[model samples]
Target: MGRTALIVIDMLNTYEHEDAQVLVRSVREALPGVKTLLERARAADAPVIYVNDNFGRWRSHHGEILEAALAGPRADLVEPIAPDEESLFVVKARHSAFYETPLAYLLGRLGAERVVLCGQVTEQCVLYSALDAHIRHLDVVVALDAVAHIDADLADAALLMMERNMAAELRPNGDITFGDARSD
Candidate 1:
């Protein structure tokens, strides 16, 4: 069987943008579920890849990004889900994790045939990343409760599209089992 990886996208946010408050609230609501999923993935020894937006800092490294987020207003969100030493980090310039990022190559290197997407902005980054993953012929799974969004209606629509168009599996965090049981 192929390997599985958990893609945590845009969770290291500063919450300083236009709709930051809304997004932060949603993220906070989803924290418990996301945390549980993280623990399960780690325990299963599944690869945890953090895909974050560079926030226009072309030269910023992961350390710098972590520092900025930790010092910012949304530190609660960033701190709880901070990438550990064993976790992989990828900086993306766009909504999709695969867009101008090394995510695809990294997944390939890890022999990741399936990816569990969890994080913020469900309608944007998660949706786009799912699309890209579909195009790459990778099995996509979205943790419904582990992802937060700025708009509820749009996020629901996006999830529906992913299910119908991309055949992405939508399941709650509790239902997700990493490693050998992932394919089921």
Candidate 2:
């Protein structure tokens, strides 16, 4: 099998605030699992790509994420972590990373055929990425604990949907590491 890539969508700290944090949605609960995957990917030298939502501002997403994170009392909150010099950062304007983004080319260049999709608003961005992965015929898996949304019930529903309909295996965070080549 080809090497794998871990795509983390919209896991930045900017969305962690209460107001902008989506009262009915959040990925905070998934942070631990997401972090675990990141650490493992880093250790294994696997490509860990941050597929950030440009949020429609074509010119200033980097600043927008920062401004959103630092506005008002949120300034005291942790800054949205910058993509490390080592990791790849792909800013996306739309829901799917494969749309209007070089993500596909990047993956091709990386020689990765398997992808682990994880991140916030499991019903939204995460859902879109999984579907896109399936459409693209890439081997896709959605990390279970590595996803979050404010509505716990809805989040669970989304997970079930992905499992049954999308063929996305839900692996609980901490139960597995990414460096392992086995799909399980």
Number of clashes recorded per candidate: 0, 3
RMSD of candidate 1 to the truth, in angstroms, is: 1.0
Maximum-TM-score candidate:
1
| Model 2, runs deviating above 4 Å | 16-26, 61-82, 180-184
Model 1 Cα lDDT, one tens digit per residue, 23-135: 88899888888888889999999999999988999899888988999999878788788888999999999999999888999999999989999998899999999999999
lDDT of 2 by residue, 55-148 (tens): 5666865556656645644343223333455778788877777878888889889888778887776777788888777777777778887776
Model-by-model lDDT, in order? Answer: 0.91, 0.70
Q: Clash pairs of candidate 2?
A: 25-150, 26-149, 26-150
* Model 1: CA > 4 A from native: 181-183
Q: How many backbone clashes does candidate 2 have?
A: 3
Q: lDDT at 97 for candidate 2? A: 71
Output the worst ten-in-a-row residue range by lDDT, candidate 2.
73-82
